[model samples]
Target: MGNAAHEEVIASINSQISETNALINAALVAGTPTDKLRKKLATLHGDLKTAQEFEAAGIADEQAKDEAFVLGAGTEIAASTIAAVNAELEALGVVCRIEQGGDRFAEVAHRIAVALRIHEKVREKIGEAAAAVERLETRINECAARRATITAARLDGKSSDREVNEFVALAADIDALNGLLYDARAKLDGIDDSAEKAAVERLRADMQQLVSATLIEAVTVHVAQAEIALLDGIRKLHRTGLKHAPHRGSTPRSHYLMNADLDFFCRTGALR
Candidate 1:
């Protein structure tokens, strides 16, 4: 039986013992035979004692289970593939303390696991964002070099229709790179790390400078106006994405509350 069942058994036996003692008292007051009633009370005491023992054993078994779970979770966290997660666990002082098995221990371990999972998810997205940013930077640099070459040719009075068309083509390339940057920034919507966020912002600023310079060197007012419109579009998309993005550092709690992964972890005690 479970601990609660054992407690119920103890309670029932105690009630029986109490009723038998009442009978014995009434018999004494009436000067009647009370030997059988006394024997029944003694039997009830024995039953109560057995029930209490069972309850204690059940509690011990539960404690053992808790201890095992805590130990296993600690091991898993220590060996997590994400170095940042492991470092966070260490900073939180949760390592090597799982032997303290109880509700509190379980709660702390669960919180750690949830945080680790959230961090892993964010890290993966950030990696993707970083790659996207790199691609955008590469394309922007190529466009800038091409613009510089065309501008030099124009200054030398060697400009032709083909050069004008190529210069205008740089606007299309910038538009595409802007789209890539927009996606990268979107991926960072829920990022919690300050350093990572700052790094991305710096990369964005540098890219913007390159783009502005390239557009200013446009050979005609019409082309410059078009490039400015493209830049404005990028700024609009960025502002909209940031405005609608989930609040920073809120991803962990939101994910924990709504994610099926939490249910799976609660059932299996295994990290995905």
Candidate 2:
């Protein structure tokens, strides 16, 4: 029966039960035999109980339907939320893969956290890589300028005190440049992608060649024997892999120079 009709049936049964009880009470007060009225009242109460049970069952059925609809809606929302978060991650050049199942709300929340973490890490690495490249390029230009200054001085095989002092100073500047390059290359360690790392390494190689060529030019200028020895020592140390010396008690300046010399030797064939 329709819900409204079923409710009407229950109300009708309850009204009959009440009327039967009133007739039974009236017959007893009139001192008449109440057996038939009492029997009718008992039958009405039984009918009322049956009707109420059916109504209770119908209400439970309706509640179940409502809960099912809500669950379906919740599932749809969870799916859309995951899709949106995945799209955002892809825009940031990251891929998010999540296995489906379990509590959907919890899964979506976890996916969002994972996507955010990946995006932040990639951004941080990219920034570091760019900064490292910039630093290396800047130091390369600075070294080039210093080399030009030394070239213009034109010592011409002279052994004068002033010529020796100038070569010594330039050697110190070259040392400083090497340290800067090393520090810049170290920053590349933060990048995890093989292709990106390889591209930066290639650029590092090119920069190393430019700087080593500058060193070769300086050596050919016939500076003091002592200054020549100093330049040669720098080359040999790098060539023989002494640049990877232990880091105990080393200052930042020393650490930067220590790792950069190897790149110079590797690119220039200075050992040959």
Candidate 3:
């Protein structure tokens, strides 16, 4: 990219990061509740804000400095959230990687990341969710085992009534932990999906930097389909003979023609 393009992209990211950071600070102050996080998220990005203010151009003076600061803070906050979430996930993933049965879940999570081109850090966090569930389940099992042991000992009346009650209470604790674990696991299932959405948002930001417009079009062409047109052009030239194909002309013209062909070929996925 040219220096201008680079600057544009960097500025856009910085603007968003700053705004996100601001909201993060606000959230930290208010406490990171789900509702507050959702509210912070619905705010517009820098590009969107700028475009929205397009009508202000005719004013005596229009300053974007204040707006920039808010956007920049928010961007930073969002980025930090992504990083923390990912780190938690990564730790969980490594912890639960021992068994092949657990690995299937990891694989499924990984597939979601790949399908969405999610940032690697976020994917790591998504993987950790399952690990957390596994840990919770382990805790529940431990409580159950302890309670069972105590109950069996009670068959001989070796334990006190208070001790039996405590064991029974632990069983209840296990049930509560299971409830939390199941809910956590369900939330984790969507983390990767949000990561996918984040990737798309990243792309949208990039497009805005390139061309500040919200209307987007995705252009994709299979190699076979794209090549068909080129092949058809060549076939037409072959059938029309040398006269219709045009002459090579002078040395300068020939060099220019060859270079253009090379450039087009490179862009058409031939080299790739």
Candidate 4:
């Protein structure tokens, strides 16, 4: 569903939850003997909180997918550019391996430094790609708003001076939006992939290292999903009123999580 539709449903659900909670509170105040209903409502509240956590987790998981895409794409661009330079060095029989014995270490380090420099260009290109996406997204949103306004004016059917002016503005906006869309598409299509693919064919240890680190970042996709599930469970228990509140446990487990994880990593240089 679209965001507006989802929001409408969420608002309705929230209203129901508030009404239920108020009813339970009123029953308690009036001595109406609604213990069973109170318990049921408590369970429903737990489930609602769980659903909210799931919703949050789902958003994080989706964002992880975007992050992985950007990092993976940027790494490929950097690796390929680095590989192209390495291939030329190989053709000239200049060994650039850091561990390959004598004086070559300096040259090898220099070459690696040069490859790292290419990463700066890679970063710039990545920034440009993000900016292009933002521009397209902004323009599309503006176009949608203008179209909605124009549609609303037409539906009114009065054809007043205000409506005529709105129609004129909408026409101008549509023209600008069309041009912006074309520019965004052209920028995306102009990205070269053949060079990146060629770099994969002639991969180096450094490129492998880069790819490995990028893959580690991609691992967050799964981590994000897992975190969502974990939070849902925690929220479920916490929302279950007095009976199942997580902190109510007599012997709460000492396993490090959240801020504890930060402390552990900072102190021990290890992640739990």
Predicted structure with the largest TM-score when compared to the true one: 2
Cα-based lDDT for every prediction: 0.65, 0.60, 0.55, 0.59
Among all windows of 10 consecutive residues in model 3, the one with the lowest summed lDDT is 211-220
Off by over 4 Å in 3: 1-118, 193-272
For this target, which candidate reaches the highest lDDT against the unseen true structure?
A: 1
lDDT by residue for model 3 (1-272), tens: 32334456556755775777787778779877556544554553545456434434422122343344434543443444334434544563422112222332333333333434335435666777778888898998889888888888888789888887898799789889989998978978767556567665664454334221111111122334456966666555555544443465333333233356667776795752
What is the C-alpha lDDT profile of model 2 across 47-74, one tens digit per residue? 8788888888888886676555545544
Candidate 3: lDDT of 134? 85
- The local lDDT score (0 to 100) that residue 190 gets in candidate 2 is 52
Candidate 1, residue 212: the lDDT equals: 47
Q: Candidate 1: deviation at residue 226, Å?
A: 41
Report RMSD for candidate 4.
31.0
| TM-score, per-candidate, Cα-based | 0.33, 0.36, 0.30, 0.33
Candidate 4 structure lDDT: 0.59
**C-alpha RMSD of candidate 1:** 40.5
Total clashing pairs for each candidate: 0, 0, 22, 0
